[model samples]
Target: MKNLVVAAAVATALSMASMGAHAASPNELAQIREQLEALMQRVDKLEKENTELKTENENLKAADEKLQANDDYLKSEARGLRKEAAQQAVEVGKVKGADWAGKVAITGDMRYRYEMISDETLSSSGVQTADRYRDRIRARLNATVKATDDITVGIGFATAEGNDPRSSNQSLTSVFSRKSLDLDLAYFDWKFATWGNLIGGKMKQPFLKPGQSLFWDNDINPEGLAVNFQGGMFFGTAYNYWLTETSGPETNLTADTMLHGLQIGTRLPIGQNSLMLAAHYYDLSAGQGRAPFYNGSNGNTTDTVVLNGTSTAVLRYDYEVVNLSAEFNTMFGQTPFQVWADVAQNQDADDLDTAWSAGVLLGKASNYRTWELGAFYQVIEKDALFAQLIDSDFANGVSDSEGWVVRAGYAPVRNWLINATYFLNKRNIDAPTSAGQLDIDYDRLQVDFNVKF
Candidate 1:
């Protein structure tokens, strides 16, 4: 049988291969539903991009908490503006008070002096010889306080009385008390802008030139320490008091001591004119034992001799004194002129004599008149008054003495002053009873009325 005819042609070739796989199974189920609709449109676009990245991470965490609350409100407004600038710096240091408690200062001067003295020579202790009219009064008051800024403290009061031209002319109607308003000048001043001033208690002592009265006696006032300086060349130094002691010897042997002095100065200027130089030193002793002319009497004491039984007599006195001066002041137009010269030396007992003077002054004050013209010449050598009258025999061996003065002044109003003066004196004594020599001369005329404030 040919194997049943090839099994019927293999069952008709498996029925046409199952009809071509059922026609490709409806196009593979329509291409698997178009690939599941393109995978659900890409999972709905990845879930809308995960909800837009969670709303941009909650908007960057709310802008980082609003920038940390604006940095804590700018650090609490800068700590309340630094606590109101530290309470306005403590109320401006409590209204600025005490830096030395309100300082106060006052100064004063009042003067009324009139003097007239002429040819005096009459004194057997019953002294009287004059043609005079005198009245003097001076006043001063000053005060200050400023405990800082280079420190300062001051106080002063002064008063003066006059008429002591060797006492006579009714004793000048009594007012004898020159400078007793106490404390002429109490001081403490120090300023140094390159070493210029320094002062300590009881002032006024700078060799000479404070209106020059020819060395000493401008109503004598002196105490301690003083120094002054200026660069264009001017300097000073002082420590004063040549002698001071009231009453002793017999009222129980009382004693006091003080006699130490020194002063130095310098000043220089040429073209316009200015020149001054000075030096002075003194150290005197023997502070006690008053009256009886220091008991060493030698007027022959009516003859008394006792050798070893003790009846002694040995007289010689003088401690020390030295002075030197030079001056020249100038101004030609407004009128201010001065020329002065001086020399004084008394080395005491050892006898080294010198006393000299030369002067010239011309002045002017405007708005009417305040004139002046002066001339002077003086020489007292012969052992400088023989050691200043060594225990007096009415002052021995006094050889030469000369003087000259002429003055004129007028002020009209402001403090009132008027004056006129003329004086000339000469002496050459040596007649204890005429061995032949005693020429005395004098001529004087004066009138003055002054009031100053």
Candidate 2:
């Protein structure tokens, strides 16, 4: 615009000069020069304004680019947040759909064992049998459900060769025949009071095994009703179980066999150690003179009786057993130590009715890299405990036996164990066993690999 104005002014001046030729005067020339100066000033002002506008436009463009970058970053962040939210929602839905899964618990264990049995038996023919070697396996699975706030239900299955209450081991034999899976546990426990519980069905023993006592075999699951109570340092258990049922009988004496048991104990703390003392009473009056045997008499004294038009051997005396047990636990530096003893007597038996066991354990085999060693000596006289209920591995599961049990265990990792148990025992210590009248040596070795989950 300045160039156009200047050109037009110059053209006009030239035109006047041409028209006025010699008539042109100095005044006209002065007027033209003044107009040229004004035009130059206007051009300088317009140039300054145009430079300022260009600077403002450049600043606006830079701001717009920065805003676009920030907007892209925000959009990317929103996408990530949406994905995370979706993942969380899926997890929440899964938990809501299986809410009852929290109330149920499943646990199981398996044991594989290599066993060697050596028995020294005396026979009239003077013949000796060879020692036996076998492999065995035991697997158990249990489920516990919290049915209600105060009620719990448990069910379990275990490998077994037969319905023998004293053992759950299935020997590996029979040309790969299928093994049996039997019901090992089925019970309901109700917390009827703050310090008491009512348990029924085929259930675990309610009595405490202070010394890991073998007076009652660990595998025995008694079908009965049990009540357990504990308050402060006092605890007690009572149970009644049926041994045999007799119905529609016509005889001189007829009744169902039953066993009743009660145990009471107390725990006393002494410094960092604790001591426990307990007394147990078991009565099987109804089983007297009854042929209520599962495996056999197992060296228990018996009387011959006629039943169902056949001759049979029945229990000779009632079993009214009284047991006293004590256990002391203490810590020696970082290792644990325990000492325990048990004495039992069947009051109804006239003679040979005493049983006793004493043991000491060093350390404990729990968690990884832990080990334990224990040894115990036991003497079970002929009429002491009910023979069918004793540990099957001890002295060939017979009464009138005296033995030593040495056990060692180690855990290489969590929930896995290696164990060895040796039994050096003599059967028929005082009286003849059902197998023979002569005393015999019974030795057994068991090595086990155990795993639990």
Best by lDDT: 2
Tens-digit per-residue lDDT, 1-453, candidate 2 = 778878887898799889887887888788889988888788878988998999999998998999999999999999998999999899888886677788899999999999999988756676665799999999999999999999999999999888888989999999999999999999999999999999999998888986756898899999889999999999999998988888876664578788999999999999999999999999995778887789779888998988887899999989999999999999989999999999999999999999999999998987999999999999999999988888889988889999899999999998999999999999888976345655678999999999999
Q: Write the per-residue lDDT of candidate 1 for residues 328-426, one digit (tens) a residue.
A: 889878788988887776676344256667777878432356676777665554434222222111122133445565677767766566766565655
Q: By how many angstroms RMSD does model 2 differ from the true structure? A: 11.1
Give the best candidate by TM-score. Answer: 2
Which residue pairs show collisions in model 2?
none
For model 2, the run of ten residues with the poorest summed lDDT: 431-440
- Name the lDDT of candidate 2: 0.90
* Cα error of candidate 1 at position 64, Å: 11
Q: Model 1 TM-score?
A: 0.24
Please give me the total number of clashing residue pairs in predicted model 1. 0
